[model samples]
Target: MRRMQKLAVLGALMLSGAAHAQSSVELYGIIDTGVMYVSNVGGHSNWLADPGTAAPNLFGLRGTEDLGGGLKAVFKLEGMFSLNNGASVNGLFGHETYVGLRDDRWGTLTAGNQIDFMFYSLVVDRWGPAFPFVSSLSLRQGSFAGLNIPNGPPGNGSFDFDRTLGAPIPNSVKYLSPTIAGLQVGAQYSFGGQAGSFGQNSGQSFGVNYHIGTVALNGAYTYVKYPELNHGNDGIRNMGAGASWVVGPAELAALYTNTENTENGARVAVYEADVTWTFSPFVHANLAYQFMKGNETLKNQKAHQETLSVMYSLSKRTSIYSGIALQQASGGPAWISLVPGPASGGSQVTGNIGLLHVF
Candidate 1:
């Protein structure tokens, strides 16, 4: 009788263990780096360590657990690090660390450090920073005097597609609504977390998207506050919209962003258009043009950027690419180029061959 009781208890424990094992976890990451030459830095031609304008290097743990009914619990912990020096990022998991719940019929609500609604749009314009070769060049000029630039890529910081406030807001909570009739919407808020002020450094953003057939559209707005930068608090208010069309092996996309500094009232606008073509299962090409106009439009202070990227896949997780990036300015400040110059009439050009691997 005692032996039978013990076996019964053991079987019950095994069943419980199996039930708990229904949860799943995954480890994923990407690494990309390259080399290149800069036209003029401090009036001298320079060849330097070009950390390819690809994804930031990172690794992360993400998992989901199925609860009863149609609900599920989800969590993600990811970190950014430098590939050149192998140094762990201070964020530890600051890149994207969050916990939440989801339901197919309902939606998803997550809390922690996360990107804004515009950054997460499913139909995000393809004219973003993730393109090959010229991504770093784009990021270098992504910022203005008082505004912020969206962080680029999943784990890397160099190449992001869209230009927005790049830093993930801390102490944040977000909600994503389920798609209804090809339309999806999301909203997010990040508490300032200040000791006594609710509006000091907080941020709020919302995005709406629509997709039908081979066409998709996106629109987003964000307000980010900066408290410590200047004696008086400052921030950036942004509004953006994008559209894309897909036909056969080619897709065309256009994105426009306008940003205004709260304290200085400086306005900076960027317009981008891109074309992507897939030649085969293993080959692809992308061509793009970007124009940035800043402050008083009357001054003719603007910059133009162009990029061409050609890529070949070696496997599902590995690829090689070569890209050419060029920048020209007519009346913009030196801020428009990687070199130290308002070189009113000069231009910057770069080329690189790089590789990327994911697992």
Candidate 2:
């Protein structure tokens, strides 16, 4: 009789815990904005407008339900929009919305739009944020900066493609392995979604990362094949490797990327190194240098840039910043645009002043 009573109490406690876990959810997001100025672009100087936010304006929701026995159902819904232009980041396609299952012992598997393994690897390898711009630099420059053009794919008006934000993949399924003694692995695939064509514009990628104490290392590879040749034949191939070290309030990072577009027979390589020094809880400084080569604006051309900036945090969620960047292009004028397109002109300097808020 006593044993039966104890078992009933235990079961009741377990049910209560499960019920509490199932009802928990979290809402989070970051709001960043700023103003930028550029000189010597196109034939005349121009005033470049920036998104009110330093990064893409965004908001997201995350939730989890515990099923007991070290198993859980998890999901995240996130949408990105431009605060300045009031436009969706991905147009009609959702940016990063996914649902998945996670097992404490097994791993996690998710389906929907998400980041690829290569982009994630760049973050793991580099300290602080991926690049000086709003997003990871790897998106603009591949594995090694020199392997491909530093700013973007080698071509006319390539500088327009430079974005300080990370680009998420569409129609993606991703899996992340449980950490095994500080070692982790991740893989993802993006479906082309063409009727009756399984691999028309599909992409597959994978990466591995290892961290010990304050030192970390990572490597990744990605292949995007557009079989139809509508965009290009042989598609685009990107591969990258990076590393980061963190000590006290200072961190250092370096990365290299190679991006090739076989359809047009154009290739660009980029190399980058960055350092951040935190003087106090509210003050920080950043210095970065990037180099690009191969088929720049003109065939067999080259260009390079160095950027530096500093920020002072007023509070945990708000800060003010200022920065200056110097760019010099060879082969032709490398005009800078918000999105990858045609450059207005080249040999320029850019400055920005802004405030950022996070929630």
Candidate 3:
């Protein structure tokens, strides 16, 4: 009888210990699609279904396991897909895949494919008032292909040059510091994975953020080496700063970014400002303006763009939105980022209406 009682006590202890260590997993996603009307594309007006205007079509799995002693293990896997034809935008889980350990006092340290500070600081942290409002359509892709960014996507070498669209940095490690007195900092490094060259294709990024009261300030810098450029010695460099203020139901923000291709002496600079206002629990609106300019290597290309957007919430996870943007270019052809093609003229207008659902 004593032996049986000891066995029972051991089993209870095991079960109790198992109960102290807990883990959870969650699946989340967003689906957004709409009809877009472009005034001109390759000299013709067109209408088509577009994705990722209000929000990118993406899904992700996030999990956490308590490790006791104020520590936890966490992981995230995220991917993007096209809603029009149900095709993967990148590879499966190409957007973000990371595993890390978090501690209550030390913040988090993660390793895997990840985004750099450009997106985390400038877009996600500082540009809250302009993000989905100005959307990806207003990001900045012009006729500056003369920059000759080797291996760049077909077109001007400056596609998403500022890296504000969350471009993935593969084989990377990152550290996020715990917020201290309303300030937080982050850094990341990507491995080149070259046989004998450590710097080839390597990249590094750093960001800082501070918030006090209703005002927030952010800044970041990133340098990514491209093996195709200068024998992997030179690459693209980016730096940006932004600030935002909240008052009542309105948010006002401004941002500036500079991008340079060291191999070709190509450079582009952008300035932007925006405002978002909430009229009610279900209604919101935003207005924004942007100016982009390139150096002599790009024929002194310059562009001016303005955007307006409105959203109506049906519930916490569903919303309908509409947006309109106008762009004019001087010294080059006009092209809106995410649009299929460049306009035949120097001016273009685009309007979109879309539905978004989150789960």
Candidate 4:
């Protein structure tokens, strides 16, 4: 009887150890805020609290559980909020919420709300340094509302047409493949959830990345069907390619993206280039330029934008930053992304200073 009891106790202890070894979880978040000055917003200059210029205000939980045979169950729940008013930016856990399985030899498969490939390939893998150095105002959104993105924000019908600002796709299933010979690939599909149609309001995305030495190349394509357009058959289509090279303390990158609305024959193309330099362990700078042009459907609207930013790190998790952005538009009023409204004239300028902390 004593021997049997000892065996049972040992077995229980081993089971507990195995279970502990197989699972882990982590919590993380970032908070960023400061003040901003806009030279023109609706024909007036104003100063306001910056919400997410340096980096987005976000919090998240990520966890993984080992399932033996080099596989694991993984999940992430992330959300965004406003630092100025403590308001949820996209609802609770609306930024990203996914559960998936990962295989050591393969990659991962996940389902839920998630970003598409345009952000993953161009913004993240290819020109990753730009995000840390440039402000969110550098993204593209001009006076080209003819694109008429369905369900876009009021008065701004073409917000984030390129989908590089971490826009989420709802009810999506995504697959990412492991890097093979310096190349990796990913794909995603979103179910429209329409009762009688499979393609209504659906979305599809594909992305690929290849890296060798200090150079990386990336490409992505995305198409989303909207019910308000062509009886849910016509939609928005986006495609882009980008490349980046690292040189010691500096990284240089360039990208081109095209967006089109099939419903109304509207199209826009954007060209961008930027360089990021690390001057010291705590100081960094970035300079960037962008040009956007629209087709006849958008009244041939065009915009030219330039941005410069500098940052001083207090530590690995905290920083102080400042930036200025200038924009000039022809064929319509000037509009910068994240600004409250369109410029009354053809030009606009903005400056900002901010603090960032991560945990």
Candidate 5:
């Protein structure tokens, strides 16, 4: 009886060790803050408290449990907040929160609030060359707030695809496919939580990416339903394709995007190009241009925006940045710069200098 009990105790200890080896968790986040000067916001030069442009100001936790047989269970919870202010996010894991199952060969399946296809397109190909300097948020989302004349400097106008379609749709499901020969694909779907209405506020998106040595390419498509927009159930469809190439110390990229609102009949299209050069091991500069066109009935008929920025890395986790942006608009309401108020001809200039640190 004593020998049998010893064997049982040893088996229990071994099983506990196996379980410990199969489970793990981690925490991570970033904080960015800076100051920006706008040349003309509401006909005045303004200095504003600007947040970091590289990554979202957020913190998060990630955990995984090995299920054996090349499978694992994973979960993540993240949130975003303002670094300049002491305010904490009120929403539960507003930035991202998801639980999923992953397989080395089969890929991953997850459900919860998560970013859509455009994020992958920008990160993988479209904005790869300009990232950390020019900021995809500024390029893709545009300076709508600065472009509104009557709404002054804080109004949001057209060309905000991510904001309009819900960049991270809640109550969503996503699938990420394993890369094969430098190629990968992903898809997502969100169910709008309107009782008795499954389609309301719902969204769907897909993305594909391919990379080979110095060249990369990506494309994405998304269709979303906004039950309360456009005076009814408005359907919006967005599509984008882009490519980037790198040679030595220089990188170049281009992207084209289309967004249309079916119910409201509003449409917007944009073309953008960028070039980034490494002046030194720690200093980099990026120059970018964007052309935006919208429906005649909508706010902006045509706009041209240009951005120039430089970044100096203090270390792997810290950097200092400065940037300038100019914008000109024709057939639009007014000239609005990327960070300032709208001008009479929809032309304005903005500049910013700031620091960012990651941990």
Candidate 6:
């Protein structure tokens, strides 16, 4: 009886070990909160403050299982939400969700609501260095705020996208190329998912990036011509270019983007610059600005906006910040918006402050 019992215990231990070896999962998140004040607006009022809360408020799970030699299968599921109000960002899954196979030599092939090759390049260029405050928060103010281009034309002359679309993109498959001599390329396809209208609503995008020493450059092109859903189905074309350089204790970057909307012959062009300086291992600051120009002939067009922000880091994942910004509208109604975030809807703003924590 004792021998039989020992055999059973060993078998159970082996099964548990095998399960642990076959899968690995991790949970990660960030809590970003702050306060914002907007002037010359009608919604809420004076000294208005709350958690800048939703900046990077997100949680995610990721795991990988070894398949074989130089190969692995991986998956990630992430969601973004507003901590103050307990509301999720966009889709059912929220931010990003995807699964794919990766090989040392062949690169990675992923499907589901993955990121666009071009968009990823631009976001990285902005976020990698400054770590300004939190992605969802910092970019909403000042010059950096102009980079906020919606997936669809602004309604009533407001530059907001249809976050209800679940994701800016849907039914997507992506391919990433292996890097060669510091150069990498990627492509993506989004299916229209419509009956008898495959070609009518489908879209394609491509991107290329190069890095050498302390300087890196990236460019991307995207074309979408979906005319079936009446959401300006005539389509839109986007092109973006950006460059970054590191020198001594400072990192500098510049970005330019152009979008042409076919349905109405409208165009939006944006220019931005970002600089970061690390005075010490635990102390650093960032400065950024952007300019936006829309079709002046369009009623309620966006005339101009400017923003500036600075922050002091308490640690690698924690910080306190303060910022001041201004916005002016033209043609029609005034369009001085902040972040359109839940706190303020990225509406026009006058001042802001807050704290951020990441884990």
Best by TM-score: 4
How far is 57's C-alpha from truth in model 2 (Å)? 0.9
The stretch of ten residues in a row with the least summed lDDT in candidate 1 is 152-161
Error of 4 at 12 (Å): 27
Q: Model 3, stretches more than 4 Å misplaced?
A: 1-21, 128-134, 149-152
Q: Summing lDDT over every window of 10 consecutive residues in candidate 2, give the lowest-scoring window.
A: 135-144
lDDT of 4: 0.85
Candidates 3 and 4, the one with greater lDDT = 4
Global fold similarity of model 4 (TM-score): 0.93
Say which prediction, candidate 3 or candidate 6, comes out ahead on TM-score.
3
Q: Rank the candidates by TM-score, best first.
A: 4, 3, 5, 1, 2, 6
Query: Tens digits of per-residue lDDT for model 6 on 202-267?
Result: 677777888888888888777666553254256656778888888988888887876665666666
Error of 2 at 18 (Å): 13
- If both were scored by lDDT, which would come out higher, candidate 4 or candidate 6? 4
What lDDT score goes with residue 149 in model 5? 18
TM-score of 6: 0.79
- Stretches of candidate 4 exceeding 4 Å from the true structure: 1-19
**For model 2, what is the error of residue 49's alpha carbon versus the real structure, in angstroms, after optimal superposition?**
3.3
Candidate 6: worst-modelled 10 consecutive residues by lDDT: 157-166
Task: Estimate the lDDT of model 6.
Answer: 0.58
- How well does model 3 score by local distance difference test? 0.82
What TM-score fits each model? 0.83, 0.80, 0.91, 0.93, 0.84, 0.79
The best candidate in terms of lDDT: 4
Q: Deviation in angstroms for 132 in model 4?
A: 2.1
User: lDDT per model, in order?
Assistant: 0.64, 0.61, 0.82, 0.85, 0.68, 0.58
After superposition on all CA atoms, what RMSD does each candidate show versus the true structure? 8.8, 9.2, 8.4, 8.0, 8.7, 8.9
lDDT of 1 at 63: 71
